[model samples]
Target: MIRVLVADDQAAVRDGFAALVDAQQTMYVVGRAATGRESVDLARRTSPDVILMDIRMPKLDGIEATRIICTDPALQRTRVLVLTTFDLDEYVYAALRAGASGFLLKDTPRAELLHAVEVIAGGEALLAPSITRRLIAEFASRRDPQHPSPQLAELTDRERDILLLVARGLSNAEIAGRLVISPLTAKSHVRNILRKLDCHDRAGLVALAYENGLISPGDQP
Candidate 1:
């Protein structure tokens, strides 16, 4: 079963999210916490497959908690899926950098919430397409397009091409279709890109691609 720990300062949110997850046959709630510190403690004690973390919490914020848990060697297998408000793009990027596997809006549909947990537990990062373009653009603005990215030299021509598509927010299957390669081949290439780039997940690579001017806002695959 996919074990999950819900961490939100609000009781109603914790209970609601836990219920939704429990309704799923393949996933279960292992614990719940109302504060980020408690979440960190429970995460270490429970070692759940996924932690549903809220960005704002008492004592410690979810971003710090995620960072702590992610840096812990014992919790390496654990993935953190941050819960946040739609306008909190700042927190979203910060959490991803803190080693969170992904983030979901607080008002996400129940089905999507369950699916997100499963995705994170299964060792994949996910982002809502609604926020992706804005996110890329936000970082893209800070990027010095004229200087060129130093990290670009680390990739082969094909790898660089793959990174560009990834920045466009295409899935592995999508990438495969675009590149005329098998899905597994596309996924493998993505994994290699992440490893070679030393990124925590696709989220980091996406930001890196835009921050390095590899992919521009509204670019198609």
Candidate 2:
């Protein structure tokens, strides 16, 4: 079973999510917290496979909690799914930078919420396509153009192309179709890209692509 921890400042929210998550046959809620610090503490104690974290909380914030949780090399398999009110905003980006696996809007459909937790827990990510594009554009425009892309040197020309496509928020199937390659090949390329770049998921690919200048604002895949 996929062990999960639910964290939110609201009692109703926590109870609601716990009921939904725990009811799943493949997952269960191991604990719940009402503050960021409590979430961090419970995470270390519970060692859950996934954490459903609220972006804003008293005594600490979800971003810092995620950072602390991810910093421990032992919790490498522990993925964080941030719950937020905004989509692709700076708070979400900051959480991503802090090593969160993904983010879901507070009003996300119940089915989507369950699916997102499963996706992140299964080592995949749940990055919204529109959010991906916006975040990339925003980061690329603000970051220095002169930023060194040393990681690109570790990738081949084809990998570079794949990375650019990922930055453009293309899925593996889309990448395959665009490149006239098989889905398996496209998937393999993405997997290799992640391994080579030392990324956790597509979110990492997007962040890496933008930070390393592999992609720029207003650029099309």
Candidate 3:
């Protein structure tokens, strides 16, 4: 079973999400929290596989709580999936940087929400291509394109090419089709890149790609 924790300041929404998750045969809600701090506490206690976290909460905000939980060595297996009211929420990037695997709008269709939880639980980050482009463009505007992460030098030419596609929001299967490689090969490359760079998931690769100037605003996929 995939253990999950739902964290939201609103009781109704929290309960609704918990119910939806519990209905899934492959998933179960381990706990519910109404505040960011409580979510972190529950996360540590439950060691859930995935957390549906609200961005705005009492006592602590989701970003800070995500950072706390994600940075904790004991919670290393936990992945946070942020919940926001808007697709283009300003705080979403910060949550990703704080170690969240991905995010979803609160109004996301029930099926999509459930699928997102499963995706995160399976160790993949979730960001729609459109959202990825717009969000990265908006945030990358403030950053210098010349700034680069030294660790990027460790990547091979093929790995660099794959990383660029990943930052453009291509999934393993899509990347395989585009590069004429097997899906397994694409997945293996991604896993190696994550390990070499110390990233939590694909979302971290996107963030790293931008932060390290691998791709910049207005770059074509």
Among these predictions, the greatest lDDT belongs to 3
| lDDT for each residue of candidate 2 in 49-158, tens digit (9 for 90 to 100) | 99999988999999899888887777878999889887757877878767787778889999988888888887743466566557655755677758565666788899
C-alpha TM-scores of all predictions: 0.86, 0.82, 0.88
lDDT of 1 by residue, 15-94 (tens): 99999889889989999999999999998899999999999898999889989998788998898888888744787777
Ranking by lDDT: 3, 2, 1
> In model 1, which runs have C-alpha deviations exceeding 4 angstroms?
143-149
Off by over 4 Å in 3: 216-221
Flag clash pairs in model 3. none
Judge candidate 1 at residue 197 and give its lDDT: 80
Q: List the residue pairs that clash in candidate 1.
A: none
Give the root-mean-square deviation of each candidate in angstroms.
Answer: 2.4, 2.8, 2.1
Regions of candidate 2 where Cα sits further than 4 Å from its true position: 170-192, 195-198, 216-221
What digit string (tens of lDDT, one per residue) describes model 3 on residues 76-147?
889999999887777988888777888888999999888888888888544565675567567766777684
| Top of the candidates by TM-score | 3
- Provide the lowest-lDDT 10-residue window in model 1: 124-133
